[model samples]
Target: MNLPFNLSPWRTKLRLRSEAKAQVTARGSSRKKAPIKLGLPIFMMIVAVLCGLIMGLGSIQYAILIVAIIVAPLVLLMQSTTLIAWLLVVSMIVAGCLQYFARVEQAHWMPFLILAVMLARVPLDAMRAAKPGERSDGVDLLGFLLIAFVVLVFASALVNKNPPMQALVGVKQYVFPLALTAAVTLAVAPREFWLKVWRSIPWFLIAQLPLCLYQYLFVEKGTSTAFGATGIAWDAVVGSFGGNPEGGGASGALALFLCFGIASNLALLRSQQISPRLAWLSNAAAMASIFLAEVKVVVIFLPLALLILNRAKVLKSAVSAAAWLLATLAFVVGLLLVYQVLHYSNKQTGSKSLSEIFEFATKAEQDTYTYNRETGELSRTGALKTWSQENIGRGRLVESLVGYGPAASKGFSSMFGKGTVARKYVFQLQTSSASTVLWDLGVVGGGLVAAIFVLAFVRSLSLAKRLAADPPLSALAESCAVAIALTGSGYLYNNASVNVSSVQLLASLAIGMVFVLTRFAKKQAFLPAVSSQVKVVKRQVFRPRIGT
Candidate 1:
């Protein structure tokens, strides 16, 4: 990445060198710039819009407006790919939040904006890299496998009769996450670009976490409508991304991602790349997320991640983790103590004044699984029950082996079971990413998922250890290590670990950073970037006399 030799620091010399080269290039070159022809695509898109309106597809004027809003800004900002990329990330992260606040109809198109920006950069990234004789990272084989999986899901959904659009919509959501990976691998280059992305994680956390908290606290009380998501009911936590009646939306899962981001902060601190105060504050917020947003999975995963990180300052991490635990316990105690203090009596239940808040969370957690004290048997409920009844319990060998295809599992759980208990479990077709792959993609899907897990786990761990020998790369290395672990754990629970745009963007950037670090792994802190041979040669011809 460094120059072959040191050029003088003189700005005058550099300016003259640039001027002479421009004159020579103007005289020698006959090449003309190519015109960008966007007319055909524009025309086709308009035609499609018209056809949709003619065909009674609800006019699609809003859809066109959305597309225009996304496309116009991108075309204007095409020269600023990195800016566009960051903007896209911001848009994706905030769209749900915006939807919650403004009550916007559909915020999903934001991810498409993100994808369009990603695709647009492919050419520009290639051009910048070409001068140095570098080619793209190219689509990795795992990327191919992931894409194939998407095709299978989409194809399956397309042929199904039950609201096929919904099925496609569900399946399409899965792609944006992986699309992040493809975009990162394809476009990310040079140390500066990589570091910019590495550092951007904390910014994203700082920007989004507060908005999430605000919505959870002050905003949730305003109206019956949940602030960030639908169906949160009154007094539920504002966990819009993973909103249910309780569990405070998906805050706990997001907090877990902050935990992962803190790993990066630790790395940057070691390398002296970022300020210590920023690192500490960001890590503090990460610790707070567990308490502010309650989820059992966060309770399980946070400690495991810290243990894996196994920093030199064990006491420091332990204290942070302890504080998180204490805060969470305090919040629970406060919730209960206040409810007791109020002491309102409900005539229906024998118990006195059980808060609807507590009731919902308790039921949400218990509704899916029942433990028998006598036999030590646990009955399944919720998404598990759905998977069990349709794909597992009654499915024929072929269907079980392959799955009913995408959201087709949804129909299997459409009605209640014979009794109330059985029916409760059969409420919906909700399943984990792992479960879906296993049940829907069948044996082939299982094989693909397994291959991805084993490869990413082994490779990332190996890379982390190697890079940890140095301080700067350590940050990147550990981030990847944690992401790999998180990704593996997602097999059992979808949790948007690798299934949503915002998280996927982070995970993909982590994968991309790993690739960059691997290249510069034991090298010096900085490398001088040199120009192409053609530019260097052109600069040499314009040497001015020193007498003047």
Candidate 2:
């Protein structure tokens, strides 16, 4: 090497120095390129300012415009995979508008129209999309049970020569099943999409609250009319049912809203992505609105909710129970105060004093209680019993099975009836939709139908319970299932099932979405997985160097 003038050592040294320099330069560049992190307070301030701006400019029309500008493009960008989800969202918006503005009769067209649009797209998009495997066998089994029940009910109507069988068929077979299917389909969509929809629900409820309040305080007259019409004579100011106040029903709606609000609050609270302050505000608003709704049934249900919240471990059982009890007592005291004020005002106006009103209410309650006790009558509970006894049994017969051959002559009719026999039966039976189910189908048909309904209810309840046990699924599934159960219970007497109005359709759709989503929740553990993985990665990255 000496003989070669020692050039090899110098060359090797130069190469080593150059490589070290290059490595240093690369490291420096990467340090410069790293993202700048904003402080939490500053970030939150910016967000708050933006939200304030948006809210200050709030008008539904303005909101819609902004949403269209922002969301429409985003939706389009994701159209390839999310077209159906977008369509469902659009349908909901339309349904909401119809519910707010349209008459009951006019509302029927909205869902059908939406369905038509959906069908048109189905050929191009929904059908062509790689279908997920046939959903859980459980859902299929459920569908079969529902279909069988409808068949049985229709059969009963036929045997009884009930003229209203057509309505029943339309509801049980077409409307309800479709609603359920749609819900399930929507549920299988991405979590982000469903969450977006969920967020919108509270807003929708809020919007309705003012109108409902107005109806309760001003528009509703005492006497009941179809479609919430105000009768000529105004009665006591109770809220929705103006004159002859259906305080119970109004309370039911309020209770429902409370349930929804509570669910929403729980969801927001558990959402790591959302701010804690925002969650608190939402929870507060929901609670306040529920209080204003003044539904007495909540007195019974609040404890149940507290128990649930505790069971879910979202809250401390002891603290939550104490808080709930105090709140209930406060609510009762508040109601009494309000009632006293109203009662005194009425008396001062030369009407019965508040005490007199209370006495009258007490008397009526006692009368109802006494009658039920003396005669073994069911009281409020009798409605379901009556429906079962009168209608459920008729659906089991043979001739009525395939729906009594639609439009066939049946007994008792009105101008709406098909034949003399149909007219006679209609008049004799007062064949409204509720009564017609039994009158037309007979006991066998109705009983089978009833059994199917029972099965569906049981399935929904069971699934809901299972979902509630899973932290991830509990929020959406519990809310949706409870809503469906409540609505279904109402239908036992109200005939909401047979009606094809917009509100009814929207409600059914919502329920169906819940069912579908809850079922899908069983397979979803992605969030939990991602969260754990993030924690592991964070821990590894932040681990102390061996020699810092």
Candidate 3:
């Protein structure tokens, strides 16, 4: 009836341990039982209902809904094979063609839907494969950027005179949060998803080709109401090209797609596993889109693509060099042809000829000469300086640094006596590419933000280079990176900060993915001891040798 003095404490401790073990066992049983009886079936039913709704919709709606549904799963499938990647390539082509045919919004949404779906697959796949200790640092970085962006928005709100900074706050909150989510989700995606995303690029351009052709042939002379309803006179008929003097509006986007496609095709051509016909088709479509877009700067992508191609060993040294040289010459000739066509067209329309166009383009020079003739000294140069003077420093250094609140600079500058000069000038230099970074953030803020942006790009490029040695994902990453870079350059004047451009959004997302992947890859290289142990066990379980 009596236990030993020392054994009494031991029995109590044993009883406590037994109780704890039973509780742990009960919790484990409940956790295991709950998912089987409720969670999985509920999830499956929801998916089924969603699918049913998508399928029941009309063709257009169904198409859109289906794309949205498929994107996440397809992105998850990226690491398995090149098929999904190729599917995306086709989707992109279809989207492009739609855009070219004046279905601008549809074109924007189609590829976006596909890319989004593909991106969604990434997080699912990552969750499936990720170990306990292998945290996604990319997500952390995205979170940090989101926080910084929010802080900047509030900071800008405080300093500006505009009361509508609140509205701007709303926009920042929506876009950056979504962007951050998308980027983080995509970063952890499997390599296969990235490949499928790349494969879709060629198809995207192919789709756009017809749209561009349609615009060039039929829509060139017509002007549509902006934002779908409001009536406004649009005298400018820029065609598929979005907004360069020589028809380059959509040119940047088209060119970026083409560059990525071309690079990917060349890489594929080297692989005996891929059919030559597919490669030829992809390359042809890419070239045609670039030619049709007619952006002079697109020529820059050729060399960059070639450099990537050569570095990836997709092409031999001599072949890459020769191809690059030919591309350069072709681009120059194409530009000249474009100029001549514009010149001749102007003359036929009783407008200015080549010389007159040049004179117009160089009006600032003429203005300077006239000013000097009158005052015997050169007037302040550069569009920024000229605009600054005219506006009487409305967008002064302080305003530039902190931004003129939100709605303050939304309208044209009244103080300049220039009537309305297009609110774009407030955040974008008129002569420079349409970029808000410089205008909104000024030199210092813009530079700092840009440096962070560029760092992300550089890291992606480096990762792409390293992955290039692997073939499957390398071509995909390289192509996507190049496309994003080409697209980013055009934003110099377009106020990409506003999230108005789908291409800009895509570029930002792609860059975010790259940054995330780079961080993940670096961390993987230095796994902790516990992670290494888990990895060893995983490898053994997953990668059994033949006859083992």
Give the number of the best model, judged by lDDT: 1
Give the range where candidate 2 is weakest over 10 consecutive residues by summed lDDT. Answer: 234-243
Candidate 2 lDDT tens digits, 1-548: 24746678889999999999999999898885667677766855765565557757754334433444443434433433244444444433444344433422233233444443343343344344435775434446545654565565454445546546444333333434353344335433665665665665555444444544554344333234534554321222222211123222223444444554555556545644345665566555555545445444454445444444444443557776677668768866676556445333443335455567668546644452323343233333333344444334554344433433322323322224453234432222212233334433444445644554455545544555666545444555544544444444444333333332322443454445545555465555456678899999999999888875
CA RMSD of each candidate after superposition: 13.0, 14.6, 16.4
The residue-by-residue lDDT of candidate 1 on 1-548, one tens digit each, is: 68888666677798999999999998778667779999979976886676567447664435656555546655535544354365446544666564455544345456655665555555665564454764445656655666676676666455433354545444544554554555555453566666666677666556556765655455333334443333222323333343333323444346557667777777677788789888887777655544444444554465556655664445467686677567656655664554444222323323335466567546755776544444332322444554556656764565555555554433232222122122233332333556555445556666766776566656666666666656656666776777667756755554354344555555555555555565575343223223455567777887676888
lDDT of 3 by residue, 417-498 (tens): 2112234433323333322333343454444455545655566677766664456545545554665555555444233233
Note the Cα lDDT for every prediction shown: 0.54, 0.45, 0.49
Off by over 4 Å in 2: 1-105, 112-140, 153-177, 186-188, 216-255, 272-295, 298-309, 312-472, 489-515, 518-548
The per-residue C-alpha lDDT of model 3 at residue 375 equals 21
Give the higher-TM-score candidate: 2 or 3: 3
lDDT of 1 at 135: 47
By TM-score, the candidates rank as 1, 3, 2
lDDT of 2: 0.45
